[model samples]
Target: MTGQVSVAGLGPGHEAQITPEVSAALAGATDVLGYIPYVARIAPRPGLVLHASDNREELGRARAALDLAAQGRRVVIVSSGDPGVFAMASALFEAVEATGRTDIDIRILPGITAMLAAAARAGAPLGHDFCAINLSDNLKPAALVEHRLRHAARGDFAMAFYNPRSASRPDGFGRALQILREECGPGRLVVFARAVSTPEERLAITTLAEARPEMADMRTVVLVGNSHTRRVGGWVYAPRSATVSAPASDPEGDA
Candidate 1:
């Protein structure tokens, strides 16, 4: 019998958010592997082995799951949110490519990603076209992050930011706020959503003038509205149409 590898998403910290396909994969998996907290979300049972590792070891974890599949073990690699959205899917494929393994069957199961989940909880702040940006500079250069932010702002696209801040890069979020304030101005709406679907979830909505960089943490996903975003009663939303007028672009067209 041939072995298989399934890269599955756990969604945003809630069992209810996990897809039926992912649940089925977990139930049939002989081995489950993921970051420590994500692996802990899976229940232990007979004939199943769970391998949990630290956060920075994504490539190692991906390679291990591929190896287990090659050894005829049905393996599931778990990631929070969708595996393809800044998660394990790319790493898995990279490992598979490096190993040149074609005999093992590989599958990716999608789940509710953090930005969409956060937007839902905040009343559709991403209703218009938007760009999802990873604010973490661990894998990319900080200059590129700044460059993308300027372009996203210039285009007047709503923005969703992942991994907004961490202890290692304490001032990154602060600088991001400065750029947004300069480009989008002080009135644009910003939403800070922490741990969506979990008991500890918290949501804050404010304008650029009132938004503080300290509101975001590694656990938080920040959303910045396009020029047309606004608050209706207690909820915030961007209109579905881009016909709404946006702020004037800088002279060079890249703010």
Candidate 2:
């Protein structure tokens, strides 16, 4: 009895946002593994076994899931949003590569990522060319983060950021805001969508000049608009067309 593993997204904390494919995977899974909060989203049932681990244990969790699947147990790994976007699907593949376990069955299911959910809730801030970047320094360097920010701003691409700040890195987001202000100028639109689709959801719209580091935390997704992004009525959106601008230069001579 060969078993399979499915990496599925639950879609940013709303049960309604969860797709039918993910729901069906959960219903048929004999074992589910994920971060503590994500695994908690799965309901307990007669034959389903849940394995919850810490946020930093993604590789180990993937290995455990693969191990279970190799033993003929149907497994599902749940991520809050789309598994491939800064989530478990990549980690699972990394584990597969490291272990050379190409024989195990694997499936990647798509779901609405937090940035998209946030963008939708706010209107269409991502309506134009955009890029998503994770700001956490857990696996990357701070200099690299600033480098990407500079390029994104220079290219005038609408930007979405995940893991903007946390208690441990209290000042990183402040520094990021400073870089954005330098490259994009003071009037560029910025939106902070926190816990979108949940009961405690909050949305704040402002500009690079007024954006405070305190407005964002680990749970918040920050959106910085391109030069052409603007507010219409009460909603914010980027136009579908692009007006190329000269390459941006740092005002402060930091570059």
Q: Where does candidate 1 clash, by residue pair?
A: none
> Per-residue lDDT for 255 in model 2?
44
Error of 1 at 232 (Å): 0.7
Off by over 4 Å in 2: 249-255
* CA lDDT, every model vs. true structure: 0.92, 0.94
TM-score for candidate 1, please give it.
Answer: 0.96
The clash tally of candidate 2 reads 0
Q: Which 10-residue span in candidate 2 carries the lowest summed lDDT?
A: 246-255
Candidates in order: C-alpha RMSD to true structure = 1.8, 2.6
User: What is the Cα root-mean-square deviation between model 2 and the actual structure?
Assistant: 2.6
Screening candidate 2 with a backbone cut-off below 3 angstroms (N, C-alpha, C), the clashing residue pairs are none
TM-score to native of every candidate shown: 0.96, 0.96
lDDT tens digits, residue span 1-255, model 2: 668999999999999999999999999999999999999989999999999999999999999999999999999999998999999999999999999999999999999999999999888999998999999999999999999999899888999999999999999999999999999899999999999999989999999989999999999999999999999988999999888776576444554
